[model samples]
Target: MQTVNPQTILKEKFGYDNFRAGQLDVINKVLAHKHALAIMPTGGGKSITYQLPAMMFDGITLVISPLISLMKDQVDGLNTTGIPATFLNSTVDGQEQAQRMSDLRHGVYKMLYVAPERLEVPSFFSFVQSLNIELIAVDEAHVLSQWGHDFRPSYLNILPLLEQIPGHHALLGLTATATERVRENLQQLLQVTDENTVLTGFARDNLALKIIHNQDKRKYVVEYLRKNSDQTGIIYAATRKQVDELTTYLNKIGIKAARYHAGLSEKERQSQQEDFLYDESPVIVATNAFGMGINKPNVRYVIHYSVPGNIEAYYQEIGRAGRDGLPAEAILLYAPQDMHLQEFFVQKSEGSEEHKQNEYDKIREMNAFANTQTCLVRYLLQYFGETVTKDCGHCSNCLDTREWVNVTVDAQKVLANVIRMNQRFGKTMVAKVLKGSNDASIRKYEFLRELPTFGLMKERTLKELTRFIDYLTAEGYLQFEGAEFPVLKVTSSGAEVLKGQKTIQKRLEKIRIVSQSMNSDDLKLSDNDNRLFAKLKEKRLALAREAGLPPFLIFSDKTLLAMAKLKPQTDVAFLSIPGVGEKKFEIYHQDFAKVINEFIVI
Candidate 1:
């Protein structure tokens, strides 16, 4: 028996010319039976590190993933590529689980992906003790660290099992988003050495980031989708109702869309996810729950309909787009009120006071990402403790050439009104008084009408004044008291403005699709090749429908574009396309080549 070269496995099985920057290094360390901590960016070939080794290893490689969707996607793709892989997750039934366990015992598998929660099962833990497990790869490995964004207690159970399994076993911890604190924690927990740690700096050249503040979110979404009508995107709302509303409105306007949230049944969520993945629904409006482990590679954009909980979650969510190494966009529709809801969650969440404070600090950082004048990418990278040299020159802030106007008068107006109200009213009432709207709440407080600050800025609309107040709150000019029903209070910063000691330069410009040029689907498709790309996509959809596999599993749009451009007729020519391998060429080469030939004739 001869040992297979990783490069040969790379080109033959996985369909790539070479290992991505940090991939081979991590693979080599793992193959040497050394634990590795790989901090590659999302879509940076982290999977290949463990996957190629799994094929060459003598025993099964156990992959612990947090989400069932990720498990299913990878398993499906690996199995399609002729690498034997399966997942044991909540989605599997008792009979199937039993059968899979039997197969594992018989050494019929090379790699197995399981949710972290499964390690806690006594039967599952005991059954695992008997198997020859060569490697343990923890995907989204930051979950093992409490300091990380998405922490899971179940991840703690992974390392102890590795100790019990007596053998030369290697552990691999994988994550794209890890702060310095989180990275150290993962290294300590996984017992990974510094030499084996591969830190690929976090930067998505294909992804353009945009942060849109103080805009009409619903209106912006509708218009933005209409502009990018042909593209597929994920719209993440902060709540279930928002998801439903956006989905309904998008569909009502003749745009195909689906909604997903915790409110939906398991079967319903699965159907919605499939609809999006299959391209039946080109857009999905979902809460944070929809995208963690999703393996959809061709998502054109990701729009956060509201501010996410933290930069960690936001950065990870945006990493979902442009995964095929194609240009994609990430738009964050943020407003000041969005922060209040997240702050409320942090305050009410189950944690120690220290934990709550840490969460609060994260919220402030997320707010800074929205409010910062620096590069959006720089802010995010800096937050994750990476040094950035310059601006991305493509984010909303960089593209925005709008002049900042002095809003000192407006700030003073808002502050005086808050002070006049004895700092007792929330943003809404304060705005209503500023706009001179004698609503029922105002009538209830009859003394408010005669107040010196009341109706001082009647020139502004209720909405405009409300937004300005929000900006003030976000900028720390005003503070909110209480959690659920917060009231506005003037911060010392606001007092300074009122006293003419400081000035505020506010850029409340309504953010449209500012990155239209940057976000353009400017793929390198020639006019003649564009026709073939469409035809190839049609063939892909047809084959995917027949085989019951995601279209990307057969071939990514990136590969399809290559097939169209090169118009490969021979097996050699076809396999030369990136993402094409011997196994893939054997399965799909002829069918795609036939399509290309037919298109050429037409």
Candidate 2:
């Protein structure tokens, strides 16, 4: 690869000192007219891959996107960075769009974003053919593959339009997630050969992976948010209904929050989004629809209320935080029921039997990461084909104080029982039979009367036995045959263990000791003190509403909490609270002092 002085361009145009990993190499390849695919995590500067090259090339760069809101956000962001950019989408009226097209013909735009449907119009095609086109960038390019999670039919027809462009401009495809199969589909669809392949390693070192297993997920989420108050964050739910419920719960608890989903009107979505960006609201409860082009820099946390369908989706969702090079948290609250929800998605997708089975198996593998007792970061890296020998120490599992025991004898007995039962039963029945539950299903199968290991293993609970099976699955000693009513199938490793040729060690997951004293320093605040802070916030909100501004704009919750705790009795003391700007001090300093004096005298 040829080297260019990226520093010069970075300083002159983007006001940056250097390029991120693999960015310079990809830019050089695209400028040389080689079609390429770039796979970088979200917030990894994928936009610059095509934007910088557009500046050096001869003609305009056309960016194809799926969301109008995302297009507007990108155009607005680029304009702020001193780049001459525009968008042609339905959000603009006919006259405005026509004027944009006229500007394009006159070479007024260096970068133009358009929706895939807009390319279907013949006039648009004719107009594009008349320009000196430089590059075609397909954002969210995974949508082109049927194997991907979010496939769009419009993307399938995009290649023909690329063929119609007058000049030989380079083609660039970008997405956060692409398995081996999706990568192949992208290459065939874009007609790119092997020589142009550009695969950036998918490891996101800055993110810490955590998985919390609990039956009552809402309770855990509420408790976490209460403890982490005064931080900007986002919570992603799988459905719009869940978003609504979570938004209500947060608001009732006095968190400045809003909801974003496709079910809302465009105006509502815009209003909520503006409030979030301006810090008028510190938390946004949203579905998957809210995060494509959001570029907020200081989001401190991303909490998943449900398990996403695949690891790719999980990675993309969590990538929204820590963009400003600060430490941020990604928390996953999972339950065994989440697997059923993911399986429903696999069953609903369109594919042949073999393809569907393959997708189902992939989901199982992704879920296995959640059930593992090893380091979470190591498991995530290994999924993307990177190896890490040492534990990250930051993940939940590495910090856990779990106990390990040699379950080799137990595993062998379980396998012998499965073979005795003819290897035709699912996990539920197998677990019941192993624990000697004598449930109706097990009794109907008559496994209760078997002699291999039926009633002898009655001491362990069903939950424990199932967890042990998951451990065996993770260790390659067992496999779940994905078919109609999938059942457990012993692998060669399992057979070896059954014959005493191998040993398997099982570690019991550690139980976290819930601190009875909620006043611990780590929790930040006690329940009663939090409620008192909420009361103070109520007064602040009323004042802000009277002033016709946001409560945070008046004074943040942190400022109010400080007031409630320290009882600042003077202007100087009030001004010392966090987020109290000069204007806020001028407006509400007297009111806060009055409250403090009243509390002191009482």
Candidate 3:
């Protein structure tokens, strides 16, 4: 196998100076006809693995995608790069489909994107036979595994088609999220040996991860959008109704936002997505369905309005930002009720009891992530089978400046109460007993009168007690017994804590920070500095107006804030802020710096 120069290809064809990390290596292996599985982060250039190889190979590359919009987006993006690409899916009429097949047979397209369902059709199979196939690329390949975080039944049928292809063709699987189980499934489905497998590490250094505690998520979301008005970002909700409600709320607050979800008509979804892609809308409030195939680089943040099912889903959603190798943010808002919602989902799923139990266990593991005091990035990476020594200073936990108190004694007492109550009850009953809540249920059960540990921790609210129990379960001090209406079972750790043989420490809960007054200190600028910053912003707006771009395209608020602080004397120093790239620096740096210099002297 010859080594293809990815840099040369990047410059000549894609107009990029270099390949992102793991791109060149993955592409090289694929070009050599080796079956490969790439575990790249969401914005980590996974597409180029097979895309660049497709350009170098002799035949058309067939890429199987799960979403129809994603296929169209990829096809359009390929065409923009002057690559002849087309897609076959239900979106195209019968006549157009026939013509596309004819085009494929006549060697007109170098890359072809198709949905998995379409791949099962006889006509598509015949077309594949007629074309010289270089490789088969499966995007979101983790969907093929039933054990994966997100499973699609349509993807399960793609394995047999690999054997049906006529010529020598390599297989490439790409996804932002895949655990060890999902990786094994990909190998088995693609028939790739262990030696042929390539697992890229899942550490995304450019993104800062955060989990914010907020019971009133809607208020927090609204305030966040209002404060960060001129940024390109995505807000993910768990349901379509949420997407709609949040979109409407943003509009009510004077933010140009749109909603995307599966419930929307195909045309509506397409239009909304295009508007967002074209910068007609700077923000998109959406469900998980919105971001699979859409590639809009330079997204500065991805905010989760609700907790995701697992770390895998979380990583994939957050991967949408910072694709252009720039800094980005991923924030998650969580509450205890969210765990109950996930538990409900687990109970409602149609599967074997054991399978359901496995899913429930995974959900607990995921919920523990919200309560952890360790490095958020390291925790996420560890879930995906990577090891990191130190905490990432960019995450919320690292930036937090709060004092912690030991809760081991309280935890021991709580466990003792649960044990005294026979371990047959749920978390609610145990919490009520601990908080001295003599509710009807507690009174009927006579738990309030138990002298062993009744009202010992009355200072802690019901919410606090419940959180401690959740932490206890998360840290293995308590376990859930598998039965209808699951019971909380004290573990060995619980026993030790009860006997004073071990100690369990927990951070004292911090008060949730409302987004209303965040950065208020900075919001108060000196009158002179405010006037100067306003002038610089006016100059920026004028340049943006002249150039027909958004104000953010000229400079972000962070950049303006930096200008106020640094009061740069030269263009070089002025361009050093958050979003002032070379292109913008060339356009507005000197003018802004001159304004600052003149104001400072005055």
Candidate 4:
């Protein structure tokens, strides 16, 4: 086994001319017999780092993944691309499992997918140990770290079992989301130093991350689905009850949808999953249990019905959409109450005091995420330890077109009231004082009413004032000081305002759905091209139905959209499309070129 030009293999086999961010570096590290831990974003081609290297290896590259349900689809997709691969899981019958294992032993397949649980099985371990395992690649490698949000104990058996395997040449650990701590743990487990570690950073340029604050989550989701009815997506809820309720409400409103959760029977869950994967159901409402390894790449959007417990889970869930390198969106419908739900979860989770405290810390970070007026993409990337200065123009924060309103008088009123109260209260109490509320707290502090700024903002309601206070806090004019009962204090900038050296202006309103669909270079299709894309979609759906596969696996939406725009008629021209590899052209070349030819005629 030797290293060759990975770019050539990428184009000839995987149907791409360029290697994504960290794919080539990680691939080369392993091909040089160096163990590497690669932290790449979801849908960033992490599989190719190992898959391409495995094709060049003389022996089988065993991929250990925890996602058992997605193994069949992955293996099927590889087989369609003319890459010989197989998987051994509970879904395989005893006879078929034996046959696959025999084939694996005889080097009939370049790669084999297996769950991490297989490493602990005695018979399976004995057989796998005897084979010529050239390389072992662990997918979702964050599960190996105890500090990760989705950690699993089953991953503990991986390194111990691999120690005895003789033919394995190198180890690659791949994950989409990992903090500084998680990366350190993975490097230690993979026995790779930081020198060989490749990190492409956690930034999805193709995803427009939007945080919809203080909106009716259900109504927004329903309307969004109705508007984008022809597209496919997933809506994630915080609880199974929310999933069921949302599913029922959407169906009642004449929108076809399905629900998936751990509470459902295995058969029912499987059916819902299959519906979403095959595009029979355009949308799925589920809890965090739904999307781990399902590779339905054409998901146009992912709506978070509620706030996720941590950034890791949220990023991974949103990463499911636009997997085929197309423009998509991740809209998180955030409300103040979403914190209470996550706080309840943090309290109820089983962990030691330190772990609970860590969960609470993550909750606070998510709270900032929902409220921040800064660049959403920069905030997320910074959370994952990536240093990014420029704000990504794709996120809602960057796309926000609302003009700032002058609020210098309001700021003076708020800052004066905070000082009069000795900066001892939070936003709620301070806002109440400004609004001249008749609440008991205001009454208890009788002298508070005598202050000039106490009743200055009485024209506005308490809720409006509090939201203004929140905006000021997010803008750094105010800061919270405590955890249990956080109290807001005027920041240094606030003092500047009091000294008349600063002027205040606020974004008076939260953005509505006016910018729901953003313009991206890759997603742009002319009106006529869009019509052709729709026709190609119908043809793809029909072909998928006949072949018993998801339409995206046949040809991604990105590829179809490109073909429609270009109107390539010849077989050679069709093969020149971005997603068309040698094998893909060999299989579906005529089928797709005919559609473009027919469309071009009209």
Candidate 5:
């Protein structure tokens, strides 16, 4: 038997010419039989790190993922490449799962993907102990850190499970999005030293970020879809009801659309996901449930019908677009009222006080991102503790103009009202009191009407006043009293603002992008090239259906676009496309070449 080089294995097995930025480093360290913590952005080839090592090792690699959707997608792709991989998850039945376990015991598998909960089963634990587990790879490893966004209590069991495994087995922890704190916590959890970890930059230069303040999001969504109808995308709403409404509206307007959420049956959700992945629908209106580990690389845009709960979630969701290293867009439809929806969720979540406060703080960061006038990418990077001296010129803020508004007077009034009320009231009550609402509660509390700042903001609407209070709260002028009701209380900074020592300059409407150009699709292809690209996509879809694979698995849109533009006539020219490697060229080059030749000759 001969040992193969990792690069040789990569080209022969996975059909990639080169490893992504952080992939080779992580793989090298893991092959050295050391624990590795890798922090790469979405679509950064985090899977290849452990995947390549698994093929080379003498035993099986155990991959623990958080979502079953993720595990199934990975196993499917690996099998498409002729790799011996299987997943053990709740989606599979008892008989099939037992067969898989039996196969694992016989060393018929090189890789196994499972959820963390599976480790808690005593039978599964004993079964894994009987196998030669060479490495443990934890996907979405941020879930193991309580300080990270999207913490799962079940993920804590991973460390204990690893301890139970005998011998010197390597550990690999991987996540697409993690702040500095999250990264530190993951390192600590994995027990990987700094020298053993890889921190790839989180910037996705191909994604164009846009923030739209559309009062009528439905109309905006329809018109935007009308312009970019040829491209596939995802529209993420904040709730199940909104997902259904958006899906219906898009379909009614002659657009092929689907809906996905936890409210649907498992079969329905799976069907919807397959439809979108197979290009049966060009658009999917869904919640956050739709896009964890989905590998469709041609998503040209990701539109947010409502703002997300945190920057971590927002970044991860938008990353689904342009995953093939082509240009894509991310448009956020932001309204001040949408903040309340996330706040409601934060208040309702089950967690400790510290965890709840962490969530609240994340929400505040999200609010700041919504209202920021600086470079949106810079703001995001800074939040994650990365420094960029220059602005990324692609985001809405960098492309638009922003003006500062003097909100010192409004800030003073809001702080004054909170102080007068002894900071005992929530944001809504403070807004109501300041706006002089003549409701029954105001009538019943006669002393409230006697406060000096009671009616100072009567000219402002309750919504406007509440927004101001929220701005003050987010800016550190006020703090939430407790985790339950989120009452506003003046902080030390709030006291300074009230004493006329600190000034308040808010960019309330400063970073507004004109609605006309707001829906611009920034893909740099020409009309003729786009037409040819669309035709190539049809060809790819036909091949995908014939092969029983997703369109991207056959060839990504990026490759098809290249074929359309370059009109590759021979196998050599076809192999030059970015995603085309040795094995892929051997399998797919002739078909793509025929498509290009026919198009050119016609």
Candidate 6:
């Protein structure tokens, strides 16, 4: 048996000098045998909380994870530190499962990761009860709540299984993004007290947020990738059809691209994920399912080809970028029609009435977010219950050099038409009436055709008029009524504007002066540092191939960029770098120093 402390295990195993903001507190609570919940942002070091205590505790620590790929990645990373860690899931065969069970009963491993659905199997539950499980850590704990963005019914089985164990065992829950309501749901479900819950702020200043109003999504994405050349990125579409189409378009244009979705076979999905992880293709065009298990840290940007249905999903998706604390960007290509697609999804999902209403509320909030003219980062932070007193100076809104337009005259015309039509039409009919279309719908309704406001906005295109209606809906000047095929109605606030009692202004994208370019040249490193970084990356790729691991597992791109900039020549100097601790330096210092020395001497 080995006698070790948490500090020693952290230093010797993970190669880091200290814990992240909330890690030490949760680790301390777990080591003291108390129930705790940690609400942290992505890349905030949630794994270390339970891992360190698992090493120090007497019996095995059980980790309940959502994805098998995540379990495998964690186990692989732990093996590099010479720690005994294993995973039990459907991916393993019967013989391997038997052997692993035998090894576990013999106390050969300190930690084991299992999926939540495993608890429902009577034999597996009985077998787990036989072991001396000292602690239980739930990863992605937000799945336990129906109010959460990614709800999994399997998570409800965890608490009952924990109760089935003979004695008291510590519980530690971790999630990357949970709203205040979802956090309360988790605490009540897990029996964790409010005092034991720790929330690290949800702001990632390294990631810039941008919303682009583009009609041609394929062309926009292609031009965006071309502008940010030679960088690793992900383009998330709303559906598999769009993903396949974009993948083909990028590949035809000589850009290496891969597509992933639920439609692919398990093997194909795994291969596509691995290709992106290994940098075979620096670009992956995928749906939301592509990123949950991915641990790649060098993704420079994340572009949403269509707006997501809710803010939580959007935050989690964009949080995948700038994971190493380097500069990154999140660009969302939004069109007024994206909202209709999201509404269809919300209506089609299986849920109770309250759940459906909640989903629709989230959709409206997301629409307002995409149509806002305020600081993008501030809007996200505030939505997540953080009080951001200052603006994040890097977002597109914060950096906007556009002039505001007075749309009071046009707004009055649109609102007046909605009123004159008796508030009985959807946006399409109103847009047609405003644009002076001679369609049958308008011709059949003589009253609508003869209204004074009809054709008031004939100079504008239908798309332009539809955008105005969406903007008003998002701003609460207009409201939609109905569960399906919602029709628009005028609010009292809108009536005032129509009567010339109030003014309306809009931050129209078309009127905004594009005085500056959107190129990422400002983020480029110096030529010398770029050369050194390239050499270091080559060495890392070779090391990763020899070890059969992802290159980021050796050292992240941010760590490599630091090495290239500082050009550390000694073990002590290398250890001073952010990602290099004593254990990692001892293993990789000489190889990296050799490369740096060669370049410096030249």
For candidate 6, give the lDDT of residue 286: 97
- Model 5 gets an lDDT of 0.84
Off by over 4 Å in 1: 404-602
> What overall lDDT goes with each candidate model?
0.83, 0.78, 0.80, 0.84, 0.84, 0.84
TM-score for each prediction? 0.71, 0.81, 0.81, 0.74, 0.78, 0.78
* Residues 289-399 of candidate 3: C-alpha lDDT, one tens digit per residue: 878877888798999988887778888899998887789899899877776777787787776786677667677677778877778888888888877898889899888
Stretches of candidate 3 off by over 4 Å are 1-4, 349-355, 443-451, 481-485, 491-502, 511-602
Clashing pairs in 4: none
Name the regions of candidate 5 deviating beyond 4 angstroms: 1-3, 93-99, 346-348, 442-448, 474-481, 489-602
Weakest lDDT window of 10 consecutive positions for candidate 2: 514-523
Question: What's the ranking of the predictions by TM-score, best on top?
Answer: 2, 3, 6, 5, 4, 1
lDDT of residue 216 for candidate 4? 63
Instruction: Report the C-alpha displacement of residue 188, candidate 3, in angstroms.
Output: 2.5
Error of 5 at 466 (Å): 2.5
Question: Which of the predicted structures, 4 or 6, would earn the higher TM-score when compared with the native?
Answer: 6
Off by over 4 Å in 4: 2-4, 93-95, 406-462, 465-505, 510-602
Over the full model, what C-alpha lDDT does candidate 1 score relative to the true structure?
A: 0.83
The model with the greater lDDT, 1 or 3, is: 1
Q: lDDT by residue for model 4 over 15-102, one digit each (tens)?
A: 9988888788898899987889999888888989998988899888999988887788789888998889999988899999999989
Per-residue lDDT of 22 in model 3: 80
Model 6 lDDT per residue over 1-602, tens place: 23666777888888988878988889888877788999988878888898888888778899998877667877988888887999999999999999999999999998999999887788999999999888899998988998898887667877887888765678999998898889999999988898899999999879999998854676567677888778899999999998987787577556789889999998888888889889999999999987875668899999999999899989989988988889999999997778789888987888787777777778777888887777888888888888988999899888887677888888888888888888889889999999999989889888888888788889989988887788887666888776556678999898888888988766656653432222235335799889999999999999999999999999988788888877876554576566775457768888899999999998
Lowest lDDT block of 10, candidate 5: 514-523
Question: Which segments of candidate 6 are over 4 A away from where they belong?
Answer: 1-5, 412-425, 430-456, 479-482, 487-504, 511-602
